[model samples]
Target chain A: MDFFSQWVAFQTIVTKEIRRFTRIWVQTLLPPAITIALYFVIFGNLIGSRIGTMNGFDYIDYIVPGLIMMSVITNSYSNVVSSFFSTKFQRSVEELMVSPVPNYVIIGGFVTGGVCRGLAVGGIVTILALGFADLKLTNIFVTLSVVLLTAAMFSLAGFINAVYAKSFDDISIVPTFVLTPLTYLGGVFYSISLLPDFWYNVSLINPIVYMVNGFRYGILGVSDVSLWVTYGMLTLFIVSLYTWAWYLLSRGIGLRQ
Target chain B: MSSALKISGLKKTYGNTFEALKGIDFGVQPGDFMALLGPNGAGKSTTIGIISSLVNKSGGKVEVFGKDMDTQPYECKLDIGIVPQEFNFNQFEKVGNILKTQAGYFGIKPGLAEERAEKYLKLLGLWEKRDEMSRMLSGGMKRRLMIARALVHEPRLLILDEPTAGVDIELRRSMWDFLREINEQGTTIILTTHYLEEAEQLCRTIAIIDQGEIIENTDMKSLLKQLDKETFVLDVQGDLEKVKSIQGYRINLVDEHCIEVEVSKGQTLNQLFSDLSELNIEIISLRNKANRLEELFVSLVENKGAA
Candidate 1:
């Protein structure tokens, strides 16, 4: 199949993917929204009432961007990792591999699903954030663009993780070791400006910091770094990760016997 | 000019030195059921994998219905469907949905896909399990479901790898009946199975591959004739064969009740029985020694002493 037919297959894959997660909506889509709500209540309203603002914005508002972005990051990563690994575990991947579908189509199909799930959970959490505070979208285009780019980037990351994964343990290792650290140091709860000079310079190299702040700049109209630079970094990461995923798939990575 | 599958000089050497298929070549005639029979390491699955474009070939050319697989894969692969040895359908999906989704994979539209899905599912006895999760289906049902999914496209050439493995005898027999009907209606089939009896019963032509090479490829009757050149078992009442005289047969006194002899296919057991009668020995019974092909297969792959 060429690009158009593959695009159709991609649509089927995304719909199936959305259905897979949504079929057990209480476990998949609801958890992130509820978790984001809890974050707002405990960290935004209860705790922010004492900590005050670090980025010249109200504490509740500052944390809202991070909480929403966190939803995007975790949901996107988990969605692809779990779905791809389950397909492999069930040995159903051979069904797709033998078909006329190209490797890129398979990659596009799964990654797009992850991005949709990520952005979807992010969108739901964003709506839930409205109940806590007046959420801002200073630039609707930027917010939507950055949210999509971040979702794509993390979804690609999750796909690569799935390719290298052998078991359920392999899926969780990256999230626990890499993703958790990245999200925590991602300038989600606090600004990089609050870090000491050396620590601030160290945090500059962290990719998630740019993603969170790019989203921050999108939502609240404030950022610690250049918005263009954040967009540039996100664009680069998206290409690099997607390219790596396609390469792994073409190589059959861990899939072929 | 009329081959359903054409493979030429295919090789697959993985991870440097392990060459699974070392330059193999064959073709399946259209509307024929060709059985690929081989020992464990004879590279049947690798060949199937390459033809289906799942495993990348190290070297060679393949064409389906005369279309080059490399240059125009989609057109070549569109007419072929593969049913692997293992269960590969989506277990979480229903039997109906799995077939429908598989049809959609081939760009078959939804309405037509559903119609085809229902037809194959009903034919495979899976219409009853249409709404049930595939993981909940029995193993035999899953096997049938795989066949349904493969046939949803109404493929012209079907490749089944061990389609009857691990299946119960009743299901296996019925499945063979179903496949025979399909092949009679002109769907070419290439099946690889460890069930020699299945191959013997279904395939008109058989190819015996050993160590990545085709050792013998001939009509199934001719292959069976290799074993008909056979063994003779003598059932005598008492100790008799202390003295044995037979030119074309190797005779042995196994015990008081029996003697074993290997003879050429054209040699008659009655001739030996009459010869024993001339010696005043009463014959009790006579039977062929080895199974039709088991002895020949053993002698071919093992028992090199005969060669």
Candidate 2:
């Protein structure tokens, strides 16, 4: 295929992926909105008032970046995992497998769809956060870069999960056990500075903490970790995960008979 | 003319054991309609899967329109299309969307994709259900939908794995007509079907695979000619009492009005009709006791098993 043809194939897959989630917006989009809204009401407005300020900002304000990042992480990961796995289960991925579309085009298209949904939900949750606290972006470039890179990273991770998943249960296992725990301990609700030194060091080992703190740095210019290190870690994860997913796809792992 | 598809020394083994295909070799000339026949557990599906790149081959060389599939898979894939035995489309998608999405996979522009989708849908009698979700369509419609999807790209070679399985006879005949028309228009087709009559009616070349090997690969006429005798059931207009061993024909009286005749090669049916006429018996109708191809297929497989 020529460059134009490859581009068209990529666009087709992305459009189909977007249409699939948007068509079932009640199931895919609405729940995240409601969940984020509830978090704002209960965690931000209700309990944040009692907690007062942390890290030189109001409790609600400090957690806004973390919550928004969390939404992006979870939605982006789930979107690709569920969509790709469903195709595998239905055997409809054969449509793409037998076509002239390259594996990279397929992978790029799904990741693009995941990023779109992630950014969308993150935007919605940001709007919801506005209802609880006045939030401002300290650095627009850094904020956009962190969210985009994080979404891409998790989207690639989801693709890998889908590739290895033998059943639907396998897809959720990572999210339920590894992802949820990592997100909570990543300092979504509190600064790691409040933790004992030993726990703070351990929290630093969790990848999500750097993402949350990097995004926090982007939004408020305050981070528990160095901004340079956070950016480096995000880039490293994205590159490695993308390379691994591509390898798996080219090998036809968990797909071909 | 160049061959439409060529396979040389193709082989596949599942895991560490279970050899599915063992060094099978064949080729289909451009514009030829060929049948890849086999019983369950035969390597027909495996060969088709390897050609379509759905299943990786353990060893072999496959060329589509002279392009090596291993090296130029994208180009080879673009030149061919496949309708698998099972329904593989998204059931939740609209019929039109399914075809359009398939066209898109081939990098077809939206306008052209729409036009081609409309053409195939209408040809396959699916235009009316274009707006309906695919799952809502009946079984036959779903099968037709798969055909339309496969044809959306207008591939030069089309591979159908049991395209008419479970379809009613009427629909099956119509599908045969459609397939014949396409083949006449210069599209090479490779079909795998359990119905031997379907192969006899549509394909000119036949390849029978069994026990991971191609046991028979020849022209249809030549394969049928391998049968030494054919059984025919005749309905007589007058009462027939007893079986008679006529010269060069073995006859059995099935009932008062029916008789079975086994005609060997080099025997003329005209002589039997003459004898029946002399007996004051009129022939109402006559038909083959079994599909000629079915008999040939069974004998070939049996011979291979015995060997």
Best by TM-score: 2
Candidate 1 Cα misplacement greater than 4 A, ranges: A2-4, B231-263, B268-291, B303-307
Q: Candidate 2: lDDT of A212? A: 98
Q: Write the residue-wise lDDT of candidate 2 on B249-294 in tens digits.
A: 8888888888999999888789999988877789999999999999
What are the per-residue Cα lDDT tens digits for candidate 1 across B1-307? 6688888998989887898888888888888899987778778888888888778888999989888998988887788889988888777887788887787677777788789998998898889889999999988888898998889888899999999989999999999999999999999998999877788789888777777777677788888877746777878874465437545567888887788877777887777776777777777887777555556666676743234
- Model 1: per-residue Cα lDDT at residue A135: 81
lDDT of 2 at B257: 84
Q: What TM-score does chain B get in every candidate?
A: 0.86, 0.96
lDDT of 1 by residue, A62-154 (tens): 988888889999998899999998888887887777677777777777878888888889889888988887787799888889888898888
Q: Give lDDT: candidate 1, residue B274.
A: 69
Q: Which number leads on lDDT? A: 2
Deviation of model 2 at B51, angstroms: 0.6
Give candidate 1's fnat, 2 decimals: 0.44
Would you list the C-alpha lDDT of every candidate in the order shown?
0.84, 0.92
Steric clashes per prediction:
0, 0
Chain A TM-scores of each predicted structure, in the order given, are 0.97, 0.98
Candidate number achieving the greatest DockQ relative to the actual structure:
2
Per-residue error at B54 for model 2, in Å? 0.8
